[model samples]
Target chain A: MFKATVNITLRDSILDPQGKATHHALQNLGLNQISKVRIGKLVELNIDADTEEEARSIAEDACTQLLANAVVEDYEITIHKKQTVS
Target chain B: MSTTFGIIVFPGSNCDHDAFYALDEVMGMETKFIWHKDTDLSGIDVIVIPGGFSYGDYLRSGAIARFSPIMNEVEKAANEGVPIIGICNGFQILLEANLLPGAMMHNQQLRFVCKNVFIRCETTDSIFTRGLNKDQVLDIPVSHGEGNYFISEDGLKELQDHDQIAFRYCDEHGELTPEANFNGSVDHIAGILNRKGNILGLMPHPERAVEPLLGSSDGRIFFESLLNRVVGA
Candidate 1:
């Protein structure tokens, strides 16, 4: 089994209203040092596969098809082999 | 005097009956309730997506509901210019379905809000609001947690260029006031129409305020507007 961690975020040019609101709040709270803020999602998945390549493909497919919106969002996947006890 | 409309009801949908009653009883139109698993769109002139937590709002609001079987038919119908209105959760579903542009994120306050708001009509050319003026104020109620709409700056410009903005926030006196902008939407947008001007997705619940008994009947115009279009056509 392998674990895949996916990070999804809106394209840089897209306006993230949530992030903008947070930035405003931070500025109001006297945190003028922080100029920009963007919000994204971290999704984790467990896949039982024979090869790392197969696991990576599955993760990519999930991200492209359902896990993320390609128009406004982009995603990256990191796969790690799960340690099994003897 | 009766027109048939279908309300797509997912498992967690709680406002299906409210939508049905509002259209049938208040708007004097025939209504049908369709399940999400059904892949049929026959004998329906209008398709409504009522407000509710579909699939327990998992993996983002309206994300799971977008993959439902019935949504396939809804997309086809919407492309053919069938009038479709997605309210609250329905709006999220529409966004997930890609029938409408942009996305809905959590409110700025990161809280669920339920309150009455005033929205100004931004466009009168769509079939949904055929006779309404471009600047009419509508006192409606909104209830949702992820009702904040987000889009790219170019996307916003495109929507404005296409005249697809269906509604904007406005004061009680029908003035383009800043305070009416609830949830911190860009350009004070409250609701919007698609490029074709047939599909509309808004966070406000028109079904919840269709009768005077509900203390506000301002939302009735939305139903009345669509009904008049169908009847006239």
Candidate 2:
């Protein structure tokens, strides 16, 4: 079994108001070294695929079809193998 | 000749009745309430997707609602060049359905803006704006948190080249200024039309403004303009 984690972030060209406000709040806390901040989302899926490639393909379909909106967001997928305990 | 208007009622849609009142009561048109799960759209000449939070605005505004069964028919109707109007949340749904271009983001001020504002008619080429003069200013009320419209540079250029922009946020005197763009939309766009000019997506609540007691009656004129087109044709 493989677990797929998808990280969805607003495209670089898109504005992230929530992230901007957070950045401002951080600045007030004296985090001057922070150049910028952007917000995104994380989605995890557990698939029963034998191969990592099969699990990745399924995750990719989910992201493109529903998980992430291509117009404003981009997504990255990471796979991890789960250990079986029997 | 009468026009039959279908108001799609999605879960959590609060403005369905507003569209009903304006169409069925005020204009005396045959208005039908279409449930979200229903896929049939036959006999409906005009479709109005009203505003309000759908699916609790989960994930994103209009993201979940776009998958509603009725949207399949709505998509088919759009492809056939049927006239469709999406107001507020409905606009967001249309964007998600790919019936319209661009996407909505949180307001630049990081707050919900609910107030009366002026929108200058950008183009009179669309059926929705047929009754208005070019650059005419209409007083409308906008109530939303994620009404900031965003599009890529290439997409923005396409909209410009096609004259798909229907309305722009503007001052009372019809001046497009930074302060006038309360939501900080790109190019101060408040409403837009599809390339074929058959669909309109706007953040302003025209149904709410239809009655004078509610506020401005310019919204009444907006509906009347559409009525004139659909019926007149």
Candidate 3:
């Protein structure tokens, strides 16, 4: 079994109001050195596959089909071996 | 000929009955509620994906609802030239389903904006806007948190070239201004049409404005236009 983590973020051209609001709050806390702030989503998945490549491919499909919307967002995926607890 | 309207009811759709009341009671037309799980859309002359928090608006608005079984039929029907209007949350679902281009983000103010806004009819070519003249302004109610529409520059140019823009957020005098853009949509876009012009996705709730008792009757034109297109055909 493999675990996949997808990090989805709004495209650079898209304006993120939520991130902007959070940035303002951070600035109020004296975090003035921060250059910019953007918000995104993290989606994790578990796939039963023969190989890590197969698991990654499955995760990619999920991102393209559902997890990530291509119009306003971009996504990155990472796969890791599922650690089973005895 | 008789025209039948179908309003798709997702799990959390709150505006399904509002659409029903506008179409069935006010307009005196046949309307039906189509459950999200149902795949059949045999007699629906027109489809209205009413506004509401479908699937609890989880993850993203209309994200989960787009995968509902009814969307398959909605897609097929759209391809066959059946007219479809997705209002507010329905508009988000249409975008998520890829029936219309672009996507919706949170409002510019980062809060749920509920008020009467003015939208200028940008084109009279589509079935939904045929009843109104070009540049006509309609006072419609919009209630949504994520109504900010976004599209790439190239995609927007394509829409401009194809006359696919159906409505633009405007002031009372039909002027496009920053203050009028409550949602901060690109080009102050309140609604848009698909390439074929059979599908319309808008952030405003036209059904809620169909009667004078509801604050404005300007939205009646949308239903009248669709009825004219289908029944008159």
Best by DockQ: 3
Candidate 3's residue-wise lDDT over A1-86, tens digit each? 88888999999877888899999999999999997999999988878888889998999899889888898889999998765633
lDDT by residue (tens digit), candidate 1, B1-233: 45689999999999999999998887878899999999988989889999999999987789899999999899899889998999999999998888988888677667788989888888889988886777888889989888778877888999999998888877888776666766767787778899988899988888998888886888898778877788778
Model 3: residues with Cα > 4 Å off, grouped in runs: none
Q: Taking the tens digit of each residue's C-alpha lDDT, what string does model 2 give over B1-233? A: 67899999999999999999989998899999999999899999999999999999998899999999999999999999989999999999999999999999999998999999999998889889998888889899999999999988899999999999999999999999899999989999999999999999999988988888988999988898888888899
Candidate 1, A10-75: lDDT as tens digits: 788766777888899999999999999999999998888888899999999998768887756889
DockQ of 1: 0.30
Q: Name the TM-score of candidate 3.
A: 0.97
In the predicted model 1, the residue pairs found to clash are none
**Model 1 misplacement above 4 A:** A9-40, A48-50, A70-73, A82-86
Error of 1 at A16 (Å): 7.1
Tens digits of per-residue lDDT for model 2, A1-86: 78889999999988888899999999999998998999999988888887889999999998987888898899999998774633
Worst 10 residues of 1 chain A by lDDT: A77-86
Q: What is the TM-score of chain A alone in each candidate?
A: 0.86, 0.94, 0.93
Best by lDDT: 2
Give one clash count per candidate, in the order shown.
Answer: 0, 0, 0
What's the ranking of the predictions by lDDT, best on top? Answer: 2, 3, 1
